[model samples]
Target: MSHEQLKRTALNNAHRQLGARMIDFGGWDMPVTYAGTIDEHMAVRTGAGLFDVSHMGEIEVRGAQALALVQHITTNDASKLQIGQAQYAGLTTPQGTFVDDLLVHKLSDEHYFLCVNASNTDKDFQWIVDNTKEFDAEVENTSGKYTQIALQGPRALEILQPFTNVDLGAIKYYWFANGTIDGVPAIIARTGYTGEDGFELYIDPNASEQIWNGLLEAGKPVGIQPCGLAARNTLRLEAKMALYGNDIDDTTTVYEADLAWIVKLNKGDFIGRDALARQKEQGLTRKLVGFEMIERGIGRDHYPILIAGQQVSQVSSGSPAPYLKKNIGLAYLPMSHVAIGSQFQIDVRGKLTAAQVVATPFYKRSA
Candidate 1:
């Protein structure tokens, strides 16, 4: 998409004022970098970083059948999520593939809030609305009601604790609480895309700039950098977090993506339950696996992956993991090559680069 036609988040001006290099990100005009990709990336790994994630979409499901509707749509068992908690889930197609991976936050017995991919928001909202017609539920595209900010890193709690009324340390991972931040109502969740100790806050759009500036100012003592998409990508890659369009899509199943942990077949008849059950019984032919570059080359996204000199699959997500200081990526390979230490070839440009299977979640923060 062109710059003039791209969508802008509430913090667009703040990012630009900080001299962010803007780019077209899934039709949104977003910052690709500020200081630099590596510098911002290292800062997040070492200290703290703030991200404007207002472009992510939100869908609200309410009414008596909220849990029923949520369970009917998501692969994860929403019944397991407590009122104050959230769980990662996939909006699965009937064929057992993801429409989009999302977070289901239970607000009450009758209310569920979903955080969906920015690019898939409209489609996801429509899907939920269609599903709600059969249940006693009301679905709303509540994306515009809030601005989302992510405060991430080891020092995140220390930097953000002063602004929120709720105890930051008390909100365990994957849990959230409704509270006031800087005296403004906010949903403070101990969740983040980066595999770090952090929080994702949803607050009024008008209050976005104030909180954004506040977090940055407060974090200044701890070297908090205003992060951008470039660093965000690297951080997530290191942690093995899947990127929607790249790491997964409608063509890939939860099992094939190595995300079966999120699939709760016993949740009782979700959209893809039967298909997933049959697939599990039949066994998977291929699955996503992490690989490290054996040669001095980077296997970028969509590059052809070969085994025995023939194309088997393509790299789903590939990049230089800044924290690990190595070229790493994920791809679907035949089960025969899924074992660690197994080898494959990634066709980068016109060159066949050697790669080897490796353990994932390549980076994990110290507890």
Candidate 2:
């Protein structure tokens, strides 16, 4: 798509003002770097990093059968969620493949808020709407109404605490509270993609630029960097958080992706419950696993994976983990070689490079 055809977020100008290098990420013109990926990456680890995630999508489900609609389409047990809590979930297809991975937030007994991937927003909205036909729920694509910003890293709380009246400490992980930041109404959720102690704020779009700037100013004392997507990608890789199109996609089932934890079979029927149950019984042919470059090379996305010189799988998401200071990636490997310490080779530019399976969630924050 042409640059002119790409969508722009509300914080577009704010990013440009800081001399951000913009890139075309899934039809949206987004910042890829500001002070550079390594600098931004390390900032989020040691201090804090503010990210303009306004490109993400938000959908609202309400009315009498809202919970019913949520339970039917998503794999997580929404019935167990309280009004202020959130849970990670998969929007699956009847064939047991991912439509998208999303965050489901319970706003009230009759209302649920969902955050979907940016590129799949329209399709997911349509899917949600189509599924709601069987229930008495009203679905709204409210993606345009909010700006999503993520403040992540160890010092996140210290930097964001002064701006919001939400009592950031009170909101535990995956929980959210309705509050105001700098007098702007917002939903402060203690969630993040970086696997750090941080918050994702869903706020009014009109106040996006203000919030973005104010946070930067407030965070300046602690050396908070305005991070872009490249840093975001590397950070997520280190944490082993699945990226929708890269790590998990329409053709990949939750089991194959090694994300079966999101599937609650006892929660009763969902979009892909039967297929998943069968997959569980039959066992997996191949499943996703983490690997580290054994040789001095970086495996990139879509690079061929060779077992005994025969290509079988492709690297799903690969990068040099900035925090770990090592090259790592995720890929689907046959069950015979899925165990940690199993070896394989990655065809990086026609040269086969050695790699080995490793324990996933390559990095974890201290509790």
Candidate 3:
């Protein structure tokens, strides 16, 4: 999409004022970097980095049949979730591939909140609506009601504590509490895309700039920087977090993507449960694997995978992981080639570059 026609987040002005380099991201005009990708990336690793994730979509399901509706669409078991808890789930199609990977939050006995990928918001909302015909639930696309921000890094808690009334220490991972941040009502969750101890805050659009500025001011002592999409990409890549359009999509199954952990076969008659069960029974032919470049080239998306100079699969997501200081990437390959320490080749610009399957999560926070 063109820049002029792209949608802007609530923080669009804030990012421009900070001299961020803006770019088109999934039809949204977003900041790609502030100081630079590498600099912003390192700041999040050592200190704290703020991100405007307001473009992500939110859907609300409310009524007596909310849990039933959620369980019918998502691969994860919604019944396993308690009030105030959240679970990672995949909204799957009848054919067993993902419509989108999302976070399902149990707000109450009869209320649920779904955080979906920015690009798949409308599609997901419609999918939920179409499936709700059998259940007595109300599905609303609440994407515009709030703006989201992520405060990530080692010092994230220290920077965010002063602005909220709730005790930051009490909120466990994957759990959230509605509280006031800088006197603005918000949903504060101890969840993040970066592999660090951090929090993602969902606040009213009108209050986003205030909260963003507040974080920057409060975090100044700890060297906080406003990061952008570029840094976010590298950070998540190093952490082995899947990017919806790249690492996974409608063509990839959860089991084939190495995300079987999110699938609960006992979830009971989900949209793709039967298809997934059959796939499991037959065993998987292809599997997603992580690799580091053995040659001095950076492998990228759509790059063909080869074994002994013959094509086998293709790279899905690849980047030079700044924190790990290595060229790390993920790809789908034959199960025989998915084993750790196994060697393969990636065609980088028509040149066969050596790469090897490596243990994922190239970077992990120190305990």
Among the numbered candidates, top lDDT falls to: 2
Position 263, candidate 1: lDDT: 93
TM-score of 2: 0.99
TM-score for each candidate, following the candidate numbering: 0.99, 0.99, 0.98
Model 1: number of clashes?
0
The Cα error of candidate 1 at residue 69, in Å, is 0.2
RMSD of each: 0.8, 0.7, 0.9
Worst 10 residues of 1 by lDDT: 125-134
Q: Write the per-residue lDDT of candidate 2 for residues 1-367, one digit (tens) a residue.
A: 9989999999999999999999999899999999999999999999999998988999999999999999999998999999999999999999789999999999999999999999999999999888769799899999999999999999999888999887889999999999999999999999999978899999998999998999999899889999999999999999999999888998999999998889999998999999999999999999999999999899999999999989999999999998899999999999999999999999999889999999989999899
Per-residue CA lDDT of model 1 for 1-367, tens digit only, reads 5678999999999999999999989899999999998888888899999999999999999999999999999999999989999999989988899899999999999999999999999999888777658999899999999999999999999999999889988999999999999999999999999899899999999999999999999999889999999899999988999999998899999998999999998889888888999999999999988899999999999999999999999999999988899999999999999999999999999999999999988898888
After TM-score superposition, the amount by which residue 7's alpha carbon in candidate 3 deviates from its true location, in angstroms, is: 0.7
C-alpha lDDT of candidate 3 relative to the true structure: 0.92
Error of 1 at 297 (Å): 0.6
Weakest 10 consecutive residues, lDDT, candidate 3?
Answer: 1-10
Clashing pairs counted in every model: 0, 0, 0
